[model samples]
Target: MGAAGQPWSYIQRFPTEAGVPRTYELPVAAFQPVGMRMDPAPQAPAALDPSIITEVSVFILDKQQGPFAITITGIDAES
Candidate 1:
C-alpha cells in the first residue's frame, strides 16, 4: 500500500472495529515510543491496546516507492 508523502513518524497505533482496521499517522517524532513522552508533545499519552488489536505494523509513513528493503525477526514457523 502507498500514501501521499507523509512525514516520517514513529510508533503508530491502531484500533480494530468489527474485525476491520483503522490506520493513521502519528504526529510524534520518528524516535519516540508510543507510551513515552513525545517531542512537541501530543495532547494525550499513548499505549498499546491488545484487546482490539488484530494487526500491528511498523513502517515508515512515506510514499511506497519501489526498491524497499525490510527485515523482520523472531519467527517460529515450526511451532
Candidate 2:
C-alpha cells in the first residue's frame, strides 16, 4: 500500500547544503512467487547524507485490523 500524502516535501525543510532538489523513496520488500523457497537477492541501500538528515517520520494512512510498527535502526557507532 503506497501513501497518498505529500510526505516527500518534508525533505525540503532540512539543510541540504546543495541547491538541487532531492527525493526520498522507501524500498518495499520483495514478494516471492509460489513454490519458491530460495531467498530473494539483497538490495543496495539508499545513499543518504547523514549530516543533512536531522529527523525522520512515518505515517500509517489507512485503517488496519491489527497494530503496525515501523522500526529504524543500524546506525554507526562513530556517529
Candidate 3:
C-alpha cells in the first residue's frame, strides 16, 4: 500500500520461479522504505500511516526493457 503525502515508498520482494504462480503474505510492518530524506531541513516520518494509504500497486522491479503483463486477481487488507 502506498500512502498519500509520503516521502518514502514501502516494498517487499519475494522470490519467484518463471511461469509459476504463488501466493505471498507480506506483512504491513515488514514493508521497508526504499528512500529517505538526508537534508539538513526538518525530517519526515519514516513510518507509513495506514490511515492515509490511497493506493496499492504491483509491478516488476527488474530493470529490463521489454513488454510485461501482470494480472492481479484480488487484494485484501485485514486489520
Candidate 4:
C-alpha cells in the first residue's frame, strides 16, 4: 500500500484480535545488522513490542532517494 504518496506495505499474521492498535516509528535507515553501523549517529528505531520480536523481514520500496527497505523485526510475546 501507499501512504502519503510514499510506497509502503505491511505483513499480517493469522489470529487477528481487537485491541488497542499500536504504532511504531522505525527509521528507514536503521535496518542494518548490529555490527554494521555505517553512520556515527544513531538511526531510526523500530516500534515493535520488545517482547514479540523474533525475526525481521525487509521490504524494498521504490522512491526518489532510490530503493529503501523497511525491516520488520518479530518480537517474542512471552517476555
**Across residues 1-79, which tens digit of lDDT does each residue of candidate 2 receive?**
1122312212111222234544444322221111112223233122333444444444454455666554445433234
State TM-scores per candidate: 0.27, 0.25, 0.68, 0.21
- Estimate the TM-score for candidate 2: 0.25
The ten-residue window of minimal lDDT in model 3 covers: 36-45
Judge candidate 3 against the unseen true structure and give its global Cα lDDT, from 0 to 1: 0.64
Model 1: per-residue Cα lDDT over 38-61, one tens digit each: 243243234323332333355544
For model 3, how does the per-residue alpha-carbon lDDT over 6-72 read when each residue is reduced to its tens digit?
6656666776666777778887777666554323222435555667778786657777786666666
Model 4 lDDT, full chain set: 0.32
lDDT to native, each model: 0.36, 0.32, 0.64, 0.32
The parts of candidate 2 lying over 4 Å away from their true place are 1-54, 74-79
Model 3, clash count?
A: 0
Candidate 3: regions farther than 4 A off: 36-44, 64-67
